[model samples]
Target: MPLKLYKKRYEDIIHSDLIDRKKNLKLIQLMMDMESAFSIPMIKNEAWNERNKDVIQFFQQVSNSRRL
Candidate 1:
């Protein structure tokens, strides 16, 4: 589900009095913020491919030098 939906659900839960809002408010907000932070795309496929290519070239160069 999208973050908005989760945020709404969290708001409802917080206001439902099922938990201590004053004490757990910070914790709940932190959890939501963390979820938002982590949901972003942190990895780039292009960067991964470039790194792999460099590694493969390094290995090939090492093997070629060993053979010579």
Candidate 2:
């Protein structure tokens, strides 16, 4: 079933499926692998978009500070 197909509330899953924490971890890993293999790189040509600017700057500042 698609993740969207789950009809349970978020709390329901937290209380029930969370019992299988290892399985949830594996699902998350699988999603990451699939996304990296299939996703296209966004050129992000709209550098002036305010939210994008914030995100880009945040990462840039993080990297620069980490190097120090």
Candidate 3:
């Protein structure tokens, strides 16, 4: 569903005349980067695994510090 939405938005950008070629290319790259970041394998390995516990704890500490 999300991929469908992304594809639709990508097609719209490709067809739009409002943005210049260079900027359009940059936007497309950004979208691809976002897609890669949210891919299932990356999420499962980097986010859901116990190997990243320290990383998660560090972020939690930073968040808690900001709340104080």
Best by TM-score: 3
Question: If the candidates were sorted by their TM-score against the true structure, best first, what order would they fall in?
Answer: 3, 2, 1
TM-scores vs. true structure, each candidate: 0.31, 0.31, 0.36
Winner of 2 and 3 under TM-score: 3
Query: Candidate 1: which stretches are off by over 4 Å?
Result: 21-37, 40-68
List residue ranges in candidate 3 displaced over 4 A.
21-26, 29-33, 36-68
Q: Pull out the clashing pairs in model 1.
A: none
Q: Which of 1 and 3 is ahead in TM-score?
A: 3
Candidates in order: C-alpha RMSD to true structure: 19.8, 10.4, 13.3
lDDT of the candidates, in the order given:
0.44, 0.38, 0.46
* Model 1 lDDT-worst window of ten: 59-68
lDDT, candidate 1, 1-68, per-residue tens: 54455446545644554545442554345454534554422354555446555433432332332211
Tens digits of lDDT, candidate 2, 1-68: 32332223222433555445544554444444433543313444453334445444433332332211
